[model samples]
Target: MPTYKFKYFNARGFGEVSRLLFALAGQEYTDERFTQETWPAEKPNVLLGQMPVLEVDGAAYGQSSAIARFLARRFNFYGSGDIQALEVDQVLGVVQDIINAMIKAFYEKDEARKAQFMTENKEEKLPLYLGMLEKLLVKNGSTGFFVGKSITLADVTVFDICDKIQAMVDFDKFPQVKKCRESVASNPKVKKWVDTRPVTEN
Candidate 1:
């Protein structure tokens, strides 16, 4: 096995999914966390000047989604076949859209503008994306896993995103989605890590 080093900020942000993947896979890696003050000095050395870069045997890679997908494949969490993999990718895309909207709302400085974004997120964006996710979960037989009988990358992705969404919106209407989130969170490793992971404003 190659030496794995995951570099990211102290915050969970985009990197938590990758960390969760490692935990779920029972893979040991160096968790290299940086603070905002130290990031500027260290940024230039990163492959893409981005957080959540994964280094395998000293070779660096950037982009959180790609890194998560790579780790998913490495850990056999991607899926069984091409179609299943595509399904996982589709779920990942939807999760990314949700995160993007959340980030926009999170970073808005003005109270009124932030309120508007939050309202739109809670009222419009969350419902649409989450409703779609709920439908997909139902289509997959409501098994609590997004792709196959076992947990896949899609499940992991959804679990992380929904876990975040729960802070901003109640998922009571999307029972399937809520159930899926509970399923992932109930995993022994996932639960342990989530409970112990560093807390951040984001």
Candidate 2:
């Protein structure tokens, strides 16, 4: 087995999904978390000056999605075949859209612009992306998994994002999405991680 070390901030943000992937696969890795104060000094050594870098043995890789995908494909969390992999990628793209909007709003220095971003996300982007997710679930026969007949990286990724924005999304309106998240949450290994993992604000 390759030795793994996942480096990210102390917060869940971009790092959580990969961590969830590790948990779901029952894989072991070094989870290296840095704080605001420590991160600046470390940033220079990172290839992309980003968090969520995955170090296998000594070689480093960058990007949260890339790291997550590597682990997912390695652990068989990616869907079964080519088409299923496409489905998983589609959902991951949607997730990236949602997260991009959130990150944009989070770092906005202008107070009014920040509020507008937040408002637009709650009123617009959330509904749009959630609807897309709901439609994808329906496309997959509403089996509570995004692709194939079992949990994939897509499901876990959706669960992590939804859990973060639960307050904004109306689950009653998106029953399929709700069901999918619940299915992932109820997973034995996933539940253990959720129950035991460090509590963060996200």
Candidate 3:
């Protein structure tokens, strides 16, 4: 077995997906969590000066989605074939788009512009993405999984993002999306982690 060390901040942010993947796979890895006070000292040593670096046998890799995909493939959380992989990637891309918009609004400096961005997000983008995801889940037979008959990286990724979104807005209108989120959370290992993991404000 490869020795694995994942470094990230105390918050779930981008690191949660990889952590969830590890838990779901029952993989043993060193989770190196930092705080704001500790991050600056450790930042320069990080592979890309970014949190959530996955070090495999002392070799460091950057990018959260890339790390998640690597773990997904290793643990069979990626789907069975090339087409399924593509479908998973497509969902991931859409999730990233949603995340990007949220991040932009989060960091916006102008108060009026921020409010505008947030309003547009709440009224438009959120529904648009949620509806699209709902359709994808339906297309996949609404098995509560995104791509295949079982859990995949796509399902976990979407679940994580939807959970975050739900913190800001209710997802009651998106029943399929709600079911998918519930299914991921209901996984034994994942539920354990969610119940016991360190709490953070992210």
Candidate 4:
């Protein structure tokens, strides 16, 4: 079997999705976690001088998003048709945008600024992106799944983002997002993924 080694911060900041994909695909991987002290010195040897890089058969692959896309394609999780694949990619992008906005809020100077960002996040970006998700979901005739009416890379990516957000924000006010997350969160496979997954905390 080809060897798979994933190096990243001990946290799940960026590497979680690909790791979960590996699990769901029933693939064995070497999950190597590192801290700054180790990463700065260790990273130079890799392709991009970064962690979260995956080594498959001694070939290094950087960029978390690209790594995720590659892993999804390998595992049959990308989606079905061209349109479905397109929607999947677009949805992942939307989720990424929201996550980035929220992370910005998390790292700001004062509580007031952080709270302001959180408020703006809940009021603006959250609904803008998640509302779109709700519509696409309903358009897909969502029987509680995102694309192809089944589990796909998009659903996994969305679930992780939504779940991570729910941990920080009060998402109850956004029922569409809450419902969307619940749908994905409740899936047996996904529920198991969440249950066994490592928390992205220090």
Per-model TM-score versus the true fold:
0.95, 0.95, 0.98, 0.86
Residue 195 C-alpha lDDT in model 4 = 89
- In order, what lDDT does every prediction score? 0.90, 0.93, 0.91, 0.79
Alpha-carbon lDDT of model 2: 0.93
The TM-score of predicted model 4 comes to 0.86
Ten-residue region with minimum lDDT total, candidate 1: 160-169
**Worst window of 10 by summed lDDT in candidate 4:** 167-176
Tell me the spans in candidate 4 whose CA falls farther than 4 Å from its real position.
110-112, 168-180, 186-193
Clashing pairs in 1: none
Q: Report lDDT (Cα) of residue 127, candidate 3.
A: 87
- Over 128-162, each residue of candidate 2 has an lDDT whose tens digit, in order, gives 99999999999999999999778899999999999
Which segments of candidate 2 are over 4 A away from where they belong?
none
Residue 18 lDDT (model 1):
97
lDDT for position 34 in model 4: 89
lDDT of model 2 at residue 181?
95
Residue 53 CA displacement from its true place in model 4, Å:
0.4
Identify the runs in model 3 with alpha carbons over 4 angstroms from their true place: none
Cα lDDT over the full model 4 = 0.79
Tens digit of per-residue lDDT, candidate 3, span 9-91: 99999999999999999999999999999999999998899878999999999999899999999999999999999999989
The CA-based lDDT of model 1 is what? 0.90
- TM-score preference between candidates 1 and 4, better one: 1
Top TM-score hit: 3
TM-score: model 3 vs. ground truth: 0.98
